[model samples]
Target: MPTPSEPVDEFDATSSTAADPVLPAGYSMRLLDWADLPAVHALENRLFPLDAWPLSFFEEELAQAVPEPDGGTRDYRVITGPVPGSASGTTATGTAVTGTAVTGTAVIDADRDAGAGEAADVVLGYCGLMCVPPLADVQTIAVAPEAEGHGLGTAMLLWMVAEAARRRATDLLLEVRADNPRAQRLYERHGFEHIHTRAGYYPGDASAQGAGGGRVDALIMRRRLVG
Candidate 1:
């Protein structure tokens, strides 16, 4: 039994030739909102069909973090691509607001180029983070199948790291499907190292994960946060 903290390098890789959507100038990031839930849920269902969380979870997350000042609404933003040359991603340091009570879901997006007619402000991807003792756990990250290679996942992860730092998190941990090599590469690029493995982590249909999937393993990964 290996501890979930041991670091290792090397992963089984996958090669899928997929084109990513074109993005516009100055991609922006902001908190997610209730209105964006439908799109987010759609992407999640597509990306994690086997283990998608119930819709109720989404509603609950948002409800929990609602700010009381204006009646139970969370401090979230629906990141829309700002006018080009307009500061869409710009935010004042330390003034980033949080919900009155930290009970609901917080959302954000990479939506800088959409308004320029270069891309739609649809959620090409999203990452979830939750604070725990010592570190922030990356709850999950999923990108639309069509948005695969646009580096949206990487941007989301980095944003989460910054968010975690704002919350005083010291490290980050996440579990990856054993068969997802491309994702593993993305994680590696972000300084995440394999810490351990979970056997039979993902169940597969015989059509896809047949004999080749027998050795399916989930990789537990961690990245140390640095100032």
Candidate 2:
């Protein structure tokens, strides 16, 4: 494990997830375990208060982190797999969930200096890529306000790029609030080009104007993943 104060990879964006999907070079990313829920939940709630999914949702995701050793991962979350109508459900509030975790995988790893016990996986700054056959999305990447600088966000994005490519993902996609220029810049630096935009995407009065008047837009960005 690398120490917190150690110098991180400045442009360490290249990594392969074929055999070893663990963190690349200066950073580390690992499969999420049941114990990581508390920290993940706390970050989700804090970074995305209006959109954070419930605790039960996290349980289901962790449960389906990978395919069962005997057979396969259950499709209780409509994540993928051949199930007649197996599909993850979401509330109007932007909470997408699965009754059981998806059969695929979920991963997390932060700076070792982020401290151990609970805070380790809390995503002081982190990124995730969800692979569900034929599609892969940069599910989420967040950093605590205090960790904003130090290039943690860029490192996380590079990790996701490597993960998506390893999954043989055709295209990598993610949606960021149009209002967040800093995030957009980070995405742009890593070959993500804007593909589309959604009007009134975020549902909250995070600004003084309120949800509609101060409606936030979501920019859907994409990066091709092929040789």
Measured against the true structure, the TM-scores of the candidates, in listed sequence, are 0.62, 0.63
Judge candidate 2 at residue 154 and give its lDDT.
Answer: 54
For candidate 1, the TM-score is 0.62
- Identify the runs in model 2 with alpha carbons over 4 angstroms from their true place: 1-28, 67-123, 210-212
Clashes of each: 16, 6
lDDT tens digits by residue: candidate 2, 28-87 = 445555666676667566556556668797677556556534332221111101111112
Best by TM-score: 2
Return the lDDT, model 1, position 227. Answer: 50
lDDT of each: 0.51, 0.50
Model 1 per-residue lDDT tens digits across residues 1-227:
21222112222123111112223343444566777888777655544545576778777766755433334322222323332222345321111111010111223233332343333455555555665536777766665433433344555666555555545567878777765666677778768899989887655544655556443567888887755
